[model samples]
Target: MEMLRRWLAAGLWAGTLLVPVHAEEPSVEAGLRVSRIGGCHDCHTQGFAETGGQIDPSMALKGSPVGFMGPWGTTYPTNLLLTVEPMSEDAFLDFAKTLETRPPMPWFNLHYMTEFELRSLFRYIKSLGEPGEPAPEYLAPGETPKTPWIVFAPPQMPE
Candidate 1:
């Protein structure tokens, strides 16, 4: 009877201890969920739910070769699928905290996420494992891109 009681107690203790661990570690579904909510696909891939475009699961997280031009210059989203390809998760997390990406990246949007969410995002992107060409180099104002990825039209002014 005493042996049984000890086993039960250990089981209960372990159960309680593991809850936070499981919560902190995102499952595949959870990671994917947060990625959508975080709008990661908008810039990283060609089509995403947020832009009213169809989802292309096969092309997920491959960085955009296209460029976004603005007064700040032309910027392209990094290949998030490779978030951890060059570094460990710990290192990626550190880099994320101080991420100063170019325009339209919305890195600032990520600064407030919990570590769990960030890790989940990292895990989700890592799951993709598809490497894309690095984003085109930044073009300063007045500099012309060698291969213009996108053409712009003059913004319409309200009469």
Candidate 2:
């Protein structure tokens, strides 16, 4: 009986020692949920030609076209998937800090997220593996020149 007890104690101690010491891997789905709510995919993901105007699930959060336009300039959004490369924890923290001072990114508002949430988001992005093909190119300058001087009024107004 004593020998059995000793064996059990040693087994328990060994089991404890073999247990992982680091925190568990962040939940990718949970982080994705938060990102969806946070609108990360809206700006980051490219849309597909589905009947219902669905997002391309294959390209979610993969970043914007380099020259895509909106209210922002000709810059595309960054890929959240960290697939471009593995970002160190410090790099992610620095990126989060940029939200405080950058425009067009709306990072300032996202600054309100807790550090844990931010880390989870980061992990989720990082877990996306690698980036795919580059986004489409922007139109060249003057390729579709604006001829403001030759502007015409509506048909009725012109008449």
Candidate 3:
């Protein structure tokens, strides 16, 4: 019986060694990583997409002037810095979990983010300097957008 117990322990130890370990990155660093890979800069930062991501970091997350026009009307990226600037970490987490917004915002993705990831994101955005101007208001369907906008119309099927 003692010999069997020793063998089982050894097997468990060996199994652990075979498993790959991925340590969680620190909150702010993890947030920054998530932001980059999640494509937050692509729409939230002005010139970020057009410049192929060469824009200054200072300009990031301040919101873009461009609008994405679709069937739901025009939606602009919000100023992330300002959005979370006043929220407590816990409040931000709760807000993220329940966030819902217009088209192209990908607000649904926030519901899947872990608490640690959400906290990290809030910390990272807060670290960026003071907030800038807010994006233009949402335009109802058929309303003309004053700023430069991208039309997200459905593609024509090649019959």
Candidate 4:
């Protein structure tokens, strides 16, 4: 009994010595939920809104050809996969906090998300595999876009 106890103790100690400590793996499922409810798919995924939110998982976050035009100019939904491809989790969190985009993008929302949520989101985007093609370049104010775009003029107020 004594010999067995000693052997077990040594084995446990050896196991602990070999185990590497790392941060918990970010939850991809949580990230997916965030993507859906956060309106990411509505813009970033081509045809997502038009198709009534039934986009294939394979084509998600690849960006859209459609642009949102306003007084600030025209902007396209960026390929989120490519946007974060080069960023580490920390960098992504920092970028999210400071993001400021034109017109339609809800950039302010990122600033309010917790670090865990952001990390999970980053992991989820990265897990989608290879990045998709880049979106069209930004068109300055008054410049017409070659692709289809939605105009964002203010609604006429009733006098």
Candidate 5:
């Protein structure tokens, strides 16, 4: 009986070792689809010109306009390419985890993604890493350099 037990344990160990150890990388198209569904490019990339929509493929996910304004005041999205540097499967996992802490970043709600789905998104973002021109500096509200929408108040009548 002891001999049978030993044989069983050995077989189990061998079987475990025989299984493939490497994880498969996702296809670029699959990754893009995930990003699209997650709305990653909406805040990360510059807004579209036509319908003011979010599908600007030419500047897709390249980070927000440098001087762009948002509800949080003047700020730009981080260049995801720089954030995903030294790309590796593990690095991708780390990046996905960061989504939890991101603010005004709606896609971070995807904390429930399976490891495979996260990997797909990471791969797609990494594939778009060509350096782009720097965006212009943004002036804060009430600052000297005014935005196009600034309006001056009229003089008040005597009370």
Candidate 6:
């Protein structure tokens, strides 16, 4: 009986050694969790943010059609999946760090997050598999937008 137990253990060990170990894909769930907490779905999901709905399946990370107008310019969120599809993780992180975003983008939030968080988010977005429509072009303060837009109030100057 002891010899049989030893043989079984050796067999299992040898079998495990023969099998190829595959690395698990990065976690989409982790990316989704971070995205939800970070509000990536907000402006990225067309019409969803303003309506206060949860992330829309059709519009997920596809960017809003609406534009936000401020003194600096009128800006639209980019389709995240489409934008990041061509970029490596390192390139994306570098771009995120130095992004010169316009108003209402909350670009500052990205500055506070870690690289691992960004990687997870990117991995999940990449896994979505298809690209979305490109976002509207940014318009300077006085330029006309191709679509309708909401102009924000000017900053209040201190007394």
TM-score of each: 0.71, 0.55, 0.81, 0.81, 0.57, 0.74
Candidate 5 differs from the real structure by a C-alpha RMSD in angstroms, to one decimal, of 9.1
- TM-score of candidate 1 versus the correct structure, residues matched by position: 0.71
Give residue 114's error in model 4 in angstroms: 0.9
> Model 5 over residues 35-113: C-alpha lDDT tens digits?
7777776666776434466566657677665344443345455567666665687877876766553235554566767
**Candidate 3 lDDT over residue span 37-93, tens digit each:** 778888888878778776477788888878899999998999898898789989999
Lowest summed lDDT window (length 10), candidate 5: 144-153
Alpha-carbon shift of residue 25 in model 1 (angstroms): 2.5
* Off by more than 4 A, model 5: 1-25, 49-57, 66-73, 100-102, 133-159
Candidate 4 off by > 4 Å: 1-25
Tens digits of per-residue lDDT, candidate 1, 91-130, equal: 7778878887767788887787777777777777777756
Per-residue lDDT of model 2, residues 119-144, tens digit only: 77777777676676654433342343
Model 3 earns a TM-score of 0.81
Candidate 2: deviation at residue 6, Å?
A: 40
lDDT of 3: 0.85
> Alpha carbon lDDT of residue 6, candidate 1?
100
Once superposed on the true structure, which residue ranges of model 6 sit more than 4 Å away at CA? 1-26, 155-159
Best by lDDT: 4
Cα RMSD for candidates in order: 6.0, 10.7, 3.7, 7.2, 9.1, 6.9
Clashing pairs in 4: none
Q: Report RMSD for candidate 3.
A: 3.7
Better of 4 and 5 by TM-score: 4
Which prediction has more favorable TM-score, 2 or 6? Answer: 6
lDDT of 6 by residue, 104-135 (tens): 98998888777777887888788776786888
Report the Cα lDDT for candidate 2. Answer: 0.60
